[model samples]
Target: MLLVDHVTKIFDPGSISEKVALKNVDLFLNEGDFVTVIGGNGAGKSSLLNAIAGKFFINDGRILIDDIEITNMPEFKRAQWIGRVFQDPMMGTAGNMTIEENLSIAIRRGKNRTLNWGINRNEKSVFEKHLSELELGLEERMKTKVGLLSGGQRQALTLLMATIKKPRLLLLDEHTAALDPSTGKKVMEVTKKLIADGGLTVLMVTHNMKDALEFGNRTIMMQEGAIIADIPLEEKKTMKIENLIQLFEKKSHTPFANDRMLLN
Candidate 1:
């Protein structure tokens, strides 16, 4: 459903501090494919997602979503085609908006605004059903302001908002990183259920090696802005933490070098 072709992004081009964030990176995700991305610092994981989301234009190369070229599209325009959940829980929703209000916005994605009624009975029932699956009691508190929620609760709500429209592609940028381990695991569980239930395509960036292995149909390891290894689910299931480290070292020839990642 998504394709990136030989994309490259260089920051501060021709300047002394020029840093190559992405170097001819290419990847493709078929419909319903859930791919987990892993890499150390400076691996261009975020840059790659940003490039596809059209946060900014790449210096060269093309980004296509279902055969529609969007390499140069603006971020707001791309919002209709892609859904993103960020590492920071605070980013994906309006803190002051009530739960129902926030969901009302997501439900209207990719559509022109109308003078229609908002948050009526039908929509409320749909939101309630979706929230009930999170098992977080959010369905009972639909009138509460989102800012009143805990990080995990807010993130759970954001996950729902992002997928309400069954976006063509889902981008998760270390979305569960800020939560405690148990909470993060729960969030990942919810993520898996949603993906399967909708047959959605997803690309999730994560620092935890185990999550990278356990959660997706494919695992991709990046280094210096390019994919060094792409392991299919069958091969990935047989991979231990040690095996992954070895493969990363062999491919990047420098060992996956994040202290936090190793300690985790």
Candidate 2:
């Protein structure tokens, strides 16, 4: 359902500080495929997500979603087929808006807006149903402002909002990185439930190796802007974190150096 062909992205080209964020990277995802991404700092993990999301135009190559080329499409235009949750909990929703109001916006994404009545009983019921699945009692607080919720609560809500309409692809850019470990685990559970329920195609970038291995059908390791390893489902199922670390060291010709990833 997604194809990234020979993609390359370079920042500050022709300057002394030139850096390559993506190095002719190519990736493909079948429908309902969930892939987790792991890499050290500046490994192009987030850059890959950004390129796919059209945060900036790539220097070269093509990106397609559901077989339609979106290489040059603007970010807002690509929203029709993509849903993304950012690293920051505050990035995805309107803090001042009520929970139901935020959900109303999410449901209307990529659709023409009207000045009709804000949210009907049916819509509220739908919101309640979805929020109830989070098991966070948010269904009873639909009228409460999002800003008043806890970080984990808000991130869970963001996950729901991102998948409420089941876009063709979901990009999770280290969505749980900012939460406490316990809350992060809770959000990850919500994320898994949502993806499974929707049969969603997902690309999740995470620093936690165990989470990377445990959550997705496939796990990919990146280094210096290139994909060094792509472990498929069967292989991933039998592999331990220590095995993954060994593989990384083998492929990258360097010790696994990211202390944050290692500690996680």
**Clash number by candidate, in order:** 0, 0
Alpha carbon deviation, residue 1, candidate 2 (Å): 1.0
TM-score of each: 0.97, 0.98
For 33-104, candidate 2 gives per-residue lDDT tens digits of 999999999999999999999999999999998889999999999998899999899989999999999999
Clash tally for model 1: 0
Instruction: For model 2, state the Cα shift of residue 40 in Å.
Output: 0.3
Give the per-residue lDDT digits (tens) of candidate 1, residues 1-264.
Answer: 788999999999999999999999889999989999999988999999999998878998899999999998899899998999999999999999999999999998777768564779999999999999999999999999999998889998999999989999999999999999889988988888888888899999999998888888999999998899999999998989889899989998885567756435
Candidate with the greatest TM-score versus the true structure? 2
Clash pairs, model 2 backbone: none
lDDT of 1 at 246: 91
Clashing pairs in model 1, backbone N/Cα/C closer than 3 A:
none
Q: CA shift at 95, candidate 1, in angstroms?
A: 0.6
Best candidate according to lDDT: 2
